[model samples]
Target: MKCFQLVRSVLDEIYSEIPLQDEAQKDKAIKDEILSLRSKYAKLLSSSRVIDYENPITRFSYIYSYVTSHANIVYNIIESSDMLCALMDSKKVSMTSIGGGPGSDLLGVIKYLTNASKSPTLRCNLYDRESAWGESWSDVDNKLENPFKISIYFQQFDVGEPSTWVRHVKYLSSDLFTMVYFMSEVFGNKTTAEPFFNNLFANAKKGALFLYADNNTPDFYNWFDELAHRNSLITIESTSKNFNVNYDEEKTDLGIYYDKFGFPKLTANIAYRICQKQ
Candidate 1:
């Protein structure tokens, strides 16, 4: 199967396992949780409390709506960037995605590598507080015919509690690091997050690549830029773009939620930066 199709299939299988309830009741619950998550997501960088994804439905809703939407846009952004092209050309690449749940960043990297006809052995580590996501994503990974010889390791680390984030130290010094829709989630606690990011930059191999993609907001981008400057990471390229994404009705479960919730074709206002630790 094609890469995109595989993503859809994997998600379908995972969602299928979720026990069925009244369709209307389930939709309402999912919608309510989605709205709550959206509100919490916007304030994440500033909020002192951690946003919960412990609920299975909340996790599923996130993957169904937010994760899939951002993944599509992120895939497009990576595909169009020359900097990423050069980085992915290496024979072997190590990558880590902070707050990477259920493999959105992984899928994007896989898409790019497959399209470029580059079969690099990818060692990917996904860090998130939600350990359940690791199981769901691993199921998907096991079902795929991996062209890149990708191996994924999931680390259950809470970005909100940097004091307990020691597990990630061994995974530093990677060739690439991705923060797709992630900084905004933890930016509210910049004081707590700074040390982790600083340590990451300090330990990253020289010339290691960093990809930051998120909602195109001045405050968010400014925050990331500040971090880059503080760590002496050099910005290679930065750009913002607006694009519309349409969901496939039959190919993915995402369409079911979109239709139930009356979600429009997503207009993604996204900003991305490629930097290298100097």
Candidate 2:
């Protein structure tokens, strides 16, 4: 798997640098190619009867390390230590994660709090739809308890239907502590996301702190920022950083390995936005 991934990464780097009319054209072509590859892989995996589980490549330690390193980019850029310490000292925080991939974001925040103080107790209410990994939500919760050593509630909730889920989230988070971290799962598709955000803004209380990190794209950034401005939510900070591994120099193309159809390059910019509800 590592060999395949490395080869794929190299190929993707080469394909990405393939001459195009301009940057815009390059992005469009890559975007289209990514979609096409996704469809192709979906069919191939299904045919091979491995579609129900997380891709083997995604589970490799190196791949997760690469992902977590990117996640820390948001943590380093956002100055949440003081607020996290305050919340920990109080021993009460209503934190929720939307699309918390395998609970990495939740665990990262819990580690920050635990390391900052003396055995801080925290309340994390997680929300995520079923992930491709057959590892159910319970698996993530179990791993978190031993490391962070705190009380955590794991619940399967879909962010797209904020009406059904937001009320529960509000009830779970009814006091001086509120932090919401959401990721790519919600905003990747615009049509479904618009209503979800509308419901979220209406349901969320004032003074709530929100952190969203996702694959960067102009449309996602523009729409979310616009909504923040309209709702009086102050944008505390925003950051864009590349998460792609440089593979172009190897003169390879990973896309060709996917039975002629899987997205070869996993290049994505992890962009984060910190906001406070007014």
Candidate 3:
């Protein structure tokens, strides 16, 4: 029920599937992967490069390093947003997550619903460019002891390609839409990403709620506001703040890897917005 539960599940998947010669190798492998990824992200603040996700090592490395903090940041944003909370009042609610491969977006929402003890039936659709990430999170709902009826579906979505996203219309029905750290991820390819957002906002149903949480940078947050403005989405709240990963020590479950890599991202500097389609 807690978000850490989801974090443990990711670690479990990595331990089970990734092949290593020995415990020492795992320590080296995970540590090396994390450092390489860490360096890439650090430089990404200034430039853009498409990260390869086909490698299992790369994907798992991302899971170990970023998902935890991103999920927590999302939980903090929704916990403070009354508009997102209102969706829980419905008997059945749906959400669509753009670039949700890391599983942070849904895990964050799951954590909130558990903490609130609200058990409305929830449907989740994750749209991302990588089909490989689909399997990484396929067993999540099964692993977590969800109090509510929950179902998830993954669709291959390329933000730079309109051919892929245009075919998918079911997402338009979602009561909520999440773009957690997604804009920043695709910030380099804004030329193509913009059309995708344009079509999405122009067609999304009136009254649909949107949550945008990402880096506290002008390129990221400013791009979000421009699309919202073009679409006429009513802004509920928009601000940039610092958030720490509020984790329970008892729930921590990384075994040897914990000692190898000190911890995943424990804090984030974010600019977030809660809006309603009008």
Local distance difference test, per candidate? 0.73, 0.47, 0.81
Residue-wise lDDT of candidate 3 within 1-278, one digit each (tens)?
Answer: 45555676677776666677687786677778889888877666566798887666777788877887888887777788777777876789899999997788988888888788888898999899998888777767677665568888999999899889888887988899999988888887788889899888888888899999987988789989999998898999999899988855232565555666777777888889998888
Model 2 lDDT-worst window of ten: 45-54
Question: Model 1 compared with the native: what TM-score?
Answer: 0.86
When summed lDDT is taken over every stretch of 10 residues in candidate 1, the lowest stretch is: 246-255
Best by TM-score: 3
By lDDT rank, best first, the candidates go 3, 1, 2
The total of clashing pairs for model 2 equals 6
User: How far out, in Å, is residue 272 in model 2?
Assistant: 1.6
Clashing residue pairs, backbone N/CA/C < 3 A, model 2: 8-254, 10-252, 11-252, 11-253, 11-254, 12-254
**In candidate 1, what are the lDDT values of residues 138-231, reduced to their tens digit?**
6555666655487888888876576658655677778889999888877777787888788788888888889999889888899899989999
lDDT of 2 at 257: 37
Residue 104's C-alpha lDDT in candidate 1?
77
lDDT of 2 by residue, 1-278 (tens): 12233334433434443466575664455455555434643343123222221333233222222323333433344335454344456655666665553444554564455345445455566555544322323333343334444545555555555555655645333222222223233444445556656555555667666776655666556777887777677776777767543332222333333443333334556566777666
Q: Regarding TM-score, does 1 or 3 come out ahead?
A: 3
